[model samples]
Target: MSEEEWIVDGIDHLNYRAVEGVYLSELNVGLKKLILHDYPELSDSSFVSNVHLVKYRLIFMKNVIDKANKKNDYVRETVYEVTKNQAYETMDVQEEWDNTITFGQKIADIVARFGGSWTFIISFVFLMAVWMAFNVLKPFGLVFDAYPFILLNLALSTLAAIQAPLIMMSQNRSSDYDRLQAKNDYRVN
Candidate 1:
């Protein structure tokens, strides 16, 4: 190749244009040190192509991750797993969780979603008002439940008892998902 079209790479010793990567002369001391940490044999004037640069960049990342003071071994393991190019070893937290849901968990999720909505609140208020009005005013000329509304109290109490456990179950699943997401984020970072 013509001298103007191709220049020699100081590290890989291949003929490449300057635009293909970068010259070590342009790098700061710390950056040069990081590069040299992986390719120690490279001279002070090394020219690195982009492809080889990517590999060294990964090494630089590994060095940074290794030096990190994070106390979580899960994060460290995930970083190592990714650095080793075993991407398939890691799973999508949401997808895995969704795939593992049981019928009871699905019902709990639906109940929790509805119980926390405006529609449920409005419907509940309207039902209580209608029940009290029907029993006290005797609008239908026959009050099945008297002013005390014993049946309404029983229904409300039962609803509360069942709703509480379902909502708690949903919250537990949410907490698990948050934990899985945290671990997954570490792998990406």
Candidate 2:
């Protein structure tokens, strides 16, 4: 590719002036595709992959190119406004928060974070002590979770299952945000 190729990820808007055999419309299509695939929620408008979006951007770009070739000042201004508007419209609601949040799910978040090897070992030891205490204190019959604490086991199992998915969801969101930020930075330079 030539140094003249304007590749903007998002910064101040990608602008390339002069030279090139490639159609700006094709370039825009590729860009939209990248955005849609990388960010699924952004494509919810049912138009992110629409041919019209590509055509609109291309027509605006072509207008600017034609005017620039003809040394027309108004053409540059017109294309700038039109292209900017279209691009903004396409980008407005591209962020999707599908599996984002809930209030009482904090327990899931905590379990997901500390349910690793070390945590499991520590919990096992703690449960063991609790079980021994229950046996020793059985004379008083005050053991809430006794030797066969099926309910307690079920609760932990359920927590691990739910928390695991939420943690994955959070990780995915972080990855997406990082990608979006990187794209924005790329566009600027």
Candidate 3:
């Protein structure tokens, strides 16, 4: 126990001097007001110990945290109430679009799927090799199209003209599907 005694401001009279003291004017205004607690006897020129000031700081921090927690709880409750009262339904965009897809669109999607695959690349390379070899080598007098293969060039140009539009159509439908999915998600949230 401390043998020395001191009167601390903002709090009740103290009998021990376990900690040092500071002038009330040395503290920040907010901290000073918090400790004062409307005690009329305290003044700006008064003196208080470090222990009492630290205790009041803890109290102030607790009050602020409690107020923030209460606000968070209110927000959580509001969100819960809004979600509970609403009946929400989310739809699968792909399934719904399948029901409405035209035959041409379906064909385009199938062609697009095949065109983008490794199988298409490997098979296309094999076919081109066979065509060029057949034309250049004459293949035991079986080649009707000779070197610089005009017929093969014409076939490639026609395939490109047709395949490009089919791929584009499939991509356009895919974007529309994504838009539908986004709209469905917006509604659900």
Candidate 4:
């Protein structure tokens, strides 16, 4: 190969003119150190595989560029820490959120689950039937809530008011968890 076509390090047989070519020894010292620290296995070999090294280098450079463009030090540090710790693939968003939730949030989730089930619908229908039957069949002038059933309406309204907020809370939590899981998945990929 011509002198101009060869890489500066001459370790890997990669063509300098190749589209994605990158030599391990030719990379920035800090970037190489970071990669080596993150992946100790690569440090053991004098001539790291060009393909693997280039892939990691590209990823590192992309992350660095993105963080720099965004002007966010925290994001850059977080990316570096995650890469170093190798925890991107093992992240469990559901388990993490579950562990951090309060007792009230748990109760809201349970209540929302029950409220959306067929059992709740059937039981509620049966109770309403029984309530109306008793009120209608009671002796004259002795009925607590007659035809209009003001008491039953009040109870239903109160239940709706309370259950609506609880279900919304659970749904909001679920949406947040989904967003977190998606972010983790993106990082892993």
Assess every candidate by TM-score: 0.54, 0.34, 0.66, 0.53
lDDT of 3 by residue, 4-38 (tens): 65555445566435346666788877777786775
Candidate 3 local accuracy as lDDT? 0.82
Which TM-score value belongs to model 2? 0.34
Candidate No. with top TM-score: 3
Better of 1 and 2 by TM-score: 1
Clashing pairs in 2: 9-187
lDDT of 4 at 151: 99
Each prediction's number of clashing residue pairs: 0, 1, 0, 0
Off by over 4 Å in 2: 1-128
Candidate 1, residues 1-189, lDDT tens digits: the string is: 333577678666888886787778676676688878767888766788887778767877776787674646778888688678655366778789999999999999999999999999999999999989889998758898896889999999999999999999999999989998998887666
Which candidate ranks first by lDDT, i.e. highest? 1
Query: What's the residue-level lDDT of 7 in candidate 4?
Result: 41
lDDT of 4 at 75: 76
Cα-based lDDT at residue 23, candidate 1: 76
lDDT score of residue 113 within candidate 3: 100
| Alpha carbon deviation, residue 113, candidate 3 (Å) | 1.0
- Extract clashing residue pairs from model 1: none
Residue lDDT tens for model 2, 1-189: 565655332222344332322332344564555545545444332322233344545766776688688877677778678668554322221343334445534444455467655977798789867776776578676766666676678877986687678778656655776676577655543
Candidates 1 and 3 compared: the better one by lDDT is 1
